[model samples]
Target: MTTEDTSIEQNDDELFEHHAFTVDKGQAPLRIDKYLMNRIENATRNKIQTAAKGGSIYVNDTPVKQNYKVKPFDQIRVLFEHPPYEYLLTPENIPLDIVYEDDELLVLNKPAGMVVHPGHGNYSGTLINALVYHFENLPNNSSERPGLVHRIDKDTSGLLVVAKTEESMTHLSKQFFDKTSEREYIAIVWGNVTEDEGTIEGHIGRHPKNRLQNTVFEGDDIDKGKAAITHYKVIERLGYVTLVSCKLETGRTHQIRVHMKHIGHTLFNDERYGGDRILKGTTFSKYKQFVENCFRVLPRQALHAKTLGFKHPKTGKQLSFDSPVPDDMQQCIEKWRHYAKHQDAK
Candidate 1:
């Protein structure tokens, strides 16, 4: 028998796994589940059965039951919603700022500059490493990362919800997937936003030329990207920058950053999206020096995941949590506030 295993990485919020196999002409008939068990690594019988139930197993393009007999020359394929984890999970003695913990789940405040999970070029000191060490037998998500339901960017500080049991894992994942959960972010963007409140809608996808960034597609090319929506309200208007609260309707990768940039208000100091440089303000050397000082104060993007609301997985009761803005971001905001006030008084 010959087997081919393939994994494709996507730039979006979700990842999938695909596998294919061809039965040898001389092979005898065997149960499809058993045949897959012998060929696929780390696949448990229960897992295979669950995949079969979900119609993820197929023979010659037709979904099949686990007990179906595999015939010679049959084309078998298996699809999974999430890809297998690439790196081994190791426990590390990293401290976690846990906000709330119960039998089913926990919510924590993750600091900036911390990767959520291990991936290429980042093999250690991840949130998953800390999770494995602090808790025992935490449930694995579809991607096989323990307890993770969603993630934020490495440089974006935010709140995250984690599952402790299998039931909670399945339940909480559904809430995110169905867009029933509420998430609010606070961001300081470069420019004075004219509107008090508005909604930005566009298709968000990977940038064709730049693999590291995502862009918004519109009009005739809308089909190229997935639909994303962000509702933003002006919280305060600085002289050259604006503070806004953004509510996510669809949790696409970099949704707020891309959508805001599409409208010409990129997040302040977000280096990847070109917000690190002086996008607004006068050309005077003193003004330039002041902006540079603000950049140094907030080295990363001025965005924070401030509020999260979701239904309790086990009890079906509603729960909400809020986090205070980190000190660095708060200090930077204060500086901008003072600068705007001084400019108005002059």
Candidate 2:
């Protein structure tokens, strides 16, 4: 898998950029920070040094200090947290599924594969770019993602609320920060969960070995990452896979995905978390073919933002919205239901 962690959404306010380079065989030995500054535009030696100190710079898969020399054929990779690209916010007329619209706010169902905002490789055709073209005078936060109070993963389909005015933005953001906003997600994960309802409580942080994915941290290392909590209830059992609903108390990066995987039930088809293969079920040829078909039908993670509830930013009235699962997920679930039924008969 080619690092789909870039597609995962995080709670951080800053956007991160990842870059990689291969040193030439005849390359001259130089300080890694100096070499990176020469290749990357707008890069300062201080910024590169900071990234190295932060453990975001790697030389040949090993974290190296800024003063480390670049050797011939050395593979260099760097991940840097940068402010959103201010100059890249051009209005593009990409279509949006606007479910509700008002002067102060707009609620929309974002489809899978459409990034919420411009970041790194995705500069155009984002929800923010569409909002900028469709609406006027949206509030611009510190980052370039204008009016976005929260975000869903790029491969997770679901509902999102965008603030239209500064007052609404502040009010809505406070609701999310306070954990008062109601957000529910529906997911299909590999294996049958024995628990009817359970809560996953742990600290979530970036993986120590692979910075691409999030891992649950336990023991006395409480300060390593922010506290995250997810409550889940099994909705249905479909032999190899189970449908479940998750409610998040803390919206950390990849919270649901990471928590579910921690319990040995990775999300169905979530390639980034090792759910794309046959995590469960028999190894018969027919079963293997059936799973391959399911993967084909649902190419992305089998998760969706189903419902959202919060107080009205201006009116002080409670508001809520719900969406049906997308067609692809619906169809995949039905296929599993049929397979499970047939397996029972046999």
Candidate 3:
């Protein structure tokens, strides 16, 4: 029997272009995902894994498993939907910590371990997913993400704002885009900063090769990365690490984490981009072993958006709110302080 086949010629609108391979290879069997990878080159295995979950991909003109065997007379076609991609991020019944709310906007003290939005590797249990399930109408104007103004990293806990209406979202988004909203954070870093207060200046862009991380480099064009500015001050000195307050002059992806690392003082739990080398010079080395070992108990990033202040996009009234660090962070700090004092006595 002759099998009919269809193929999609994908465009490179996204970072990488994909072309679908389909044929009437009768009576042979192969895993749907493996067959595509074998036929396609430079295609990431992870990307294939994501695409296989959807319905558009099929084997023998019928959808099958990523590991499904393709018959010899199978017709394979890839229907690549480019624009207006369907959102697979389903809403889960995750609890939200609300700090302040109004008709236009809401301020939530987003907890650690909660993903703010849906992206690769995460399809559920996200803030956006929850918002969708909760709000009857949150799609701002005509956006896929409803009521989202800004987002915090999955691990870093702090204040986040959500716009309940399109008009409000447009106004609030402008504030962040124009660098008018005031954002403040408190963090524990590995060592003492020389000046009580200072600024870290660097252009933050994606690590050209490493798709998962951001870096500080001087690039002539803005597309490489947006300008990121972090102003910080030392609040108190720990035995080895310093607890500091940070303010954002510009908001970029992972701005604080990247800037703190750039200044040689990565946040306490930010081992990914921050190294604890700040302990080299100071008396922290006295309890260096303990310093390293104690804070290590807290695995998540040691940063918090303690406070957020913004103007009402609709009411024209000033709105501000502050969030205290969760008990874990406080405990981490206290443990470090107590250990340092005990070592100093010895």
Top TM-score hit: 2
Error of 3 at 70 (Å): 27
Question: Number of the top candidate by lDDT?
Answer: 1
lDDT value, candidate 3, whole model = 0.72
Using TM-score as the yardstick, the better of models 2 and 3 is 2
Full-model lDDT, candidate 2: 0.86
Model 1 local distance difference test score: 0.87
Model 2 CA lDDT for position 341: 96
Candidate 1: residue 27 Cα off by (Å): 44
Question: If scored against the real structure, what TM-score would every candidate get?
Answer: 0.76, 0.78, 0.73
Could you tell me the lDDT of residue 91 within candidate 1?
94
Winner of 1 and 3 under lDDT: 1
Rank list by lDDT: 1, 2, 3
